[model samples]
Target chain A: MEQGLSNALNVLIVGMATVFMILWLVVIIGNLIIRVTNKYWTDEDLKKSAPKSNHPSASKGAVAAIIAAVEIVTNGRGKVTKITKQ
Target chain B: MDIFSKLFEMTAFGIVTYKTVIMWAIAFLLLFLGIKKKYEPLLLVPIGFGVLLANFPGADMGIVAAENIELPDGHYKNLFEIAHDYGILNYLYYALIKTGFLPPIIFMGVGALTDFGPMLRNLKLAFFGAAAQIGIFSVLIVSMLLGFTINEAASLGIIGGADGPTAIYTTIILAPHLLGPIAIAAYSYMALVPVIIPLVANLLMTKKEFKINMKQMDKLYPPKHQIKNIKTVKIVFPIVLGTVVAIFVPSSVPLLGMLLFGNLVKEIGSSTSRLAEAANGPIMNTATIFLGLSVGATMTSEVFLSPKTLGIVVGGFIAFAISIAGGIVAVKVYNLFAKKKINPLVGATGLSAVPMASRVANEVALKHDSNNHILQYCMASNISGVIGSAVAAGVLISLIGG
Candidate 1:
């Protein structure tokens, strides 16, 4: 009985850990790639009218929600520092 | 031979001895619900077939009786023994079925089909979705009060999350013996979302209260970094949950783990597209078929004919309705606190109907005030519900199975 109980515990731990590890790698790498792409894609000055990169309501350096969420979680709450337009 | 004797023999052969026909009728009902009502046909099809197989006698009965196989050359060994000797998969069906692996893959398909875009626009919906899952606890408490074991209560309560995979995942870990009843009940309620949710939603809100106008949260397409954050969230979310679960219930880790892995595959950008395909295509599709049938295989008359199975069915409906009520109540609370007129109707979408529930909320909102576009808000809640229920399921399993 003790062995059975321990076996169940083992199954649970190993399974959940695998999921966690996989997610950590995927999310960390995926976010980095997205951040890099965003840096290149941003149009600092509305040089091309078509490049409506600057958010209509947000500040010049405002990130997307997905990015903002990641930054806030990883870099800490204060690190996010949303730069809303004055 | 007496004529009565012949009739009795036929009756024994067909009616009492072979209960497959009645079970098949139930399977047909599932088919009707899937095809006609369009209630989660992906799972219902497989689940219905499983019922047919499970009810049919002689499935595993012969094998159950035989401890070993005897060969003419004086060799006798168990199925597992032979499998070890021959390198074959022993009771592979049970491995996937009893362990609850396949259902979570079905969830991956569900996750892939989900679009969190609307959810991003109005993140407040997450709170509402989270609130709806409160039913898991309430039901858990009730089940425990009713003298069920801790694991049984937890497994029973997860049905309130309204996510079949989470319910199955939780059950497989906490109470493997109750898998048949719990799974059947959970899937049945999930498929009946259209009917069950409306019943609960109406009970909570009147026509006037249900159709409040909520402000449209501004659309901000996620920046690249934000997209990555979401992916990171997708990744960490599962792991954090798994870790927490491991420390607690531990039995449910496998179901949670596989589910998270599938989600991780989707978030990993390099393989995102392929991961998306696997979640939606062959792996998910095939698993649904096998999982449902294999689960059905467990529902033999001897086990299913009991009052406990009936309790699972009743408990499942109660759990689902309570969660729906929880969502409605949470929305009302949010409205009172935020003082921003938000539709209580949108909260029902937190039952994880994906776009369908959101669309239903949109339709309801349109009926009241055409200008109010609450469907998007509802969609955010819908996606959040997916995550909310999954985590809640894990927690419930830990508490109960521990």
Candidate 2:
């Protein structure tokens, strides 16, 4: 029972870690897209290209990096290379 | 003084402490191999150091007893007297390693972090995992016939699967005596996958088989809907499998249960993060430290320095050879009826070293044709190998450990 509960706890951490990462990514990429494309297009066009969840247009890299770090801890060097290549 | 001098002359090298000297030499060799040559240094280095501490004849409590301490690494209760309170096996292995809990936990983090879409897309790779079991049994039968007790044979047989935990788990059940060599052999061979698999792959496959063109797989990011579905399957698959295996063979409950539980935790996706953390975090770290050290402690002179150890070492090689051959040949046979033919090298991934074996298959496939990408297809074989080896270990434990 302890083992099961411990495992369940780990799953939560992994899920949150993954969400935090994805959220951060959406934010950063959103910002970059808005800033980069604002010069070429308009704010209305940007909204059409990007979906608006709670994640704003900032801190994408931070989340992306954290997710990558957690993955590296769990999976090791092998998958990191495999994912980057993909 | 004259009697002491006479005793010194009677030793192996006419030295009073020849045995201690010999142990120290062995220790130096392990350290050198681990540090200089980089052969399984991560494990061997620590193991080598432990060996040094173990064999140092005067590590005994002799100095404190003031009996005129003369040697090193030998059993002198005066210096290292505390060791007596904890026999090497009890303090190290039974207390830590033999609880049968750590390796499967690691597998959970593996499942969570792992992407199974590759195997899902190509279900045929399961055959390769099945193929690897052939090696396990072949080694088992041979080892038993060769005069090893059933447990030893089972432990030796696991080497073919090229999995460390399964081997360690099997040894703990079947032949705890041989755990030291068996675990070391399994992990050593795993770290040598890049070296060993290629040699075996080169020997087993014909130029034609090696050169075959594998299909291209799509590399689309998993869509949101599909990802959710996979999450459900992953969680359910474990509980169902664990119940079946646990019911059939309670002996395998610790290993099979832990593995599936890890997988389920991974599958649940949102229940709790501690499951993954255990597999990925403190549990793994603590187990690794204790496991490696205990394994090292078990390698005292009496057990490790025997001719039978040679057989255990040889058994590991045989297991690897049989497993790799089983995997490659199974792929070729499966292709005869199937609409699709995969690179035969992927069969080798059935040994279940996780992404490493599968990645090696990808490398071999790429060698034949740069454009070919068989990794996704091969991954099924790899994961199946994981399940296959675990079940195989369970079977051996039931048949033997029971």
Candidate 3:
């Protein structure tokens, strides 16, 4: 039982350390790759080609239009309580 | 002699055993779950039917025969003469599964289907994926204490990842005998994520926590400024990450290589769309069917009824639960330092069931507050769980696999 506990503790430390190390590296390198790509090859066409529906601007734009309609209907008296995307 | 006696001797009824009856009932239960409950129908239906075929009296549709010999490349070479060697499912199992060829191809399909944008957008959430894998090692210890050898323990531990293919891959390498239970447990828990995650999360988190809105992430980074060249980043990520991972753990290269290869095909656009279609469509479907059938057929009564099989089933659930908790705990730890609080529910999605885990997180979030949409954040951890599991499997293989 003691031996098993020892082994489990060893695995807990080493296994977790390795996993965090690998993922930490992934996070760093992943960010670095994006930064480098953004710096060196900012292709406007490719950037435009990327889908934009999930972006804040897209959601905000939809909200702005709704707010404009609401303000007109209420003669600028009503205020937007909340704006959230489903 | 008597004609009736002769006919009876040749019939399946004569050969049927109690074990066959039990296995058939089990198969029917799986079919019920797949059809009625809609629990992973894509896999369970085929697997359930395969179980029926395998348990049929006098059918000999088992994926393995007593006379089959394993070859160097993991193919089962039938040496019991051609007359007895022509089991169709056995051929499929040996040709595809026994050679260890199917899982990587499945990963390729998964790669083609996945979008890395969510993970890229929220890199911090990626660590939650790794954190969830604590269940793997934790389970490994428990399994070892229960008398499983290191290899068997490793195979069983991977169920924590919630990634079926990685679980299957690790099992095939470390403990082929436990493949049936391990695969069943992995996929079963994956299907039950909608039920399981909420159960675990509700226990760990308060209603306020579940309702904690992360829509503010949109304001924090503003999706437009997140990444301008997502295409280039997506294309570069797999290549660079795959190389780094392979250099660190060469045993993982096969699965990671095919995964990255498929992703490259997808990201390259129209020129490679045909290849991507093949990888994610017919080829992927074919692999899934064969994988399901072979894995199901491999679970004959003698192999399936063991005490260890039951242990694997129990251990797998524990592993999965622990992984979910691990991710949540990691988020709590991360919250100690960070200004913005991440919904710990997103951490629960660190398991690699992909969109299912993320969707469940979203649903649970909606239950507390309707407008909350953490699906995008959940996806970051969800996708990272795949890579984390694959790497964990590699590490286990290096440390314990024979």
Best by DockQ: 3
Report the lDDT of model 2 for residue B75.
35
- Deviation from native of the Cα of residue B222 in model 3, angstroms: 6.5
Query: Model 1 over residues B29-50: C-alpha lDDT tens digits?
Result: 8778778877778777776766
Docking class of 3: acceptable
On a 0 to 100 scale, what is the lDDT of residue B119 in model 1?
A: 60
Query: For candidate 2, lDDT tens digit of each residue in B1-402?
Result: 999887776653542265566656777887787799886675677666766665555343111111222246663333233335444533444445555655565555555455544554444456567677676777766776677765677788788878777788778667777877787788778777877788888987887777666653233322222222343444445555566556655665666576666666655543445566667567656666666666666666666788778899898889888888888887778778765556788888888788888888788778877877777767877876776777677666665566
What candidate 1 gets wrong by more than 4 Å, as runs, is: A1-86, B1-21, B59-90, B216-271
lDDT of 1 by residue, A1-86 (tens): 44434443453344334323332333344344445544554333223332233446653344445344554456423343333344
Compute DockQ for each candidate against the true complex.
Answer: 0.06, 0.03, 0.24
Residue B215's lDDT in candidate 1: 61
Worst 10 residues of 3 chain B by lDDT: B77-86
TM-score per candidate, in order? Answer: 0.69, 0.70, 0.87
Model 3, B196-302: lDDT tens per residue? 89888988987767877888755674543357678889989989989888888777777778888888888876557778989999999999999999899988898
> TM for chain B in all models?
0.79, 0.81, 0.94
**Candidate 3 residue-wise lDDT, A1-86, digit = tens:** 67766766676677778778888878988899988888877877643443344446556457657665776567556656555468
Candidate 2, residue B171: Cα displacement in angstroms equals 0.8
Candidate 2 CAPRI classification by DockQ: incorrect
Candidate 2 local Cα displacement, residue B85, angstroms: 1.9
